[model samples]
Target: MSKHPGPSLAQHPMPWWRSGYLWLIIGLTLAMLAGGVVTVWLASQQPHAPVAAPPSQAEQGGSLEPAMQARNRTSSRNAKALGTGGD
Candidate 1:
C-alpha cells in the first residue's frame, strides 16, 4: 500500500478544462484559424478575374432621346389626324 493515499481517476473525474482532450480541441481550433488566415492572404495576393462590363446608357441609347422621340411621333400623328378631320 502507498504511504500517501492519492486520489485515483476512478475516485474523482478530472474536469474537462484539465483534460488532454481540451488541449486537442484548442490545437484544432488554432489550426483552423491559421488555415483561414493563410487562405485570405493567398486570395488577396492573386489578381482578380476580369468581369463583364455592364451595358452603358449611351450604348443602350440615351433615355431622354427615346422619350423625346416618342413624344414627337405622337404629336405628329395627332396633328395629321386633326388636320384631316377638320378639313
Candidate 2:
C-alpha cells in the first residue's frame, strides 16, 4: 500500500448550484415566465372596444323569414355544384 492514504477526489459530488443543466433549466423557466408576463402586459395594452348589438328583427323588416333561408340554401347548393365548398 502507498504511504499517503486520503479520500479520492473523484468520489466527491458536485454542488447543485454549480450544475450547468440545473442553471439551463432555471434560465428557461425564468424566460418562459418573463415571456408570459410580457404577453399579458402587451395584451392589456390593446384597445378593447364595446361590441355593438345587431338590429332587432322588427328593425330589419322581418327579412330573416323563409326568403333568407331559401337564399342561403341556394347559395350553398351553388357552391357545392361549383366544387367551391366542402361536400
Best by TM-score: 2
Per-residue accuracy of model 2 over 1-87 as CA lDDT, tens digit each = 769866676778777899999999999999999999999999899678989899898798876678777888899999999999933
The sequence of per-residue lDDT tens digits that candidate 1 reaches over residues 41-79 is 998896788898998887887677887888888888887
Which numbered prediction scores highest in lDDT against the true structure? 2
Candidate 1: C-alpha lDDT: 0.84
TM-score of each: 0.39, 0.44
Regions of candidate 1 where Cα sits further than 4 Å from its true position: 1-6, 9-18, 51-87
Which 10-residue window in model 2 sums to the lowest lDDT? 5-14
Q: Give the TM-score of candidate 1.
A: 0.39
Off by over 4 Å in 2: 1-10, 48-87
The true-versus-predicted C-alpha distance at residue 32 of model 2, in Å, is 0.1
The CA root-mean-square deviation of candidate 1, after full C-alpha superposition on the true structure, stands at 10.6
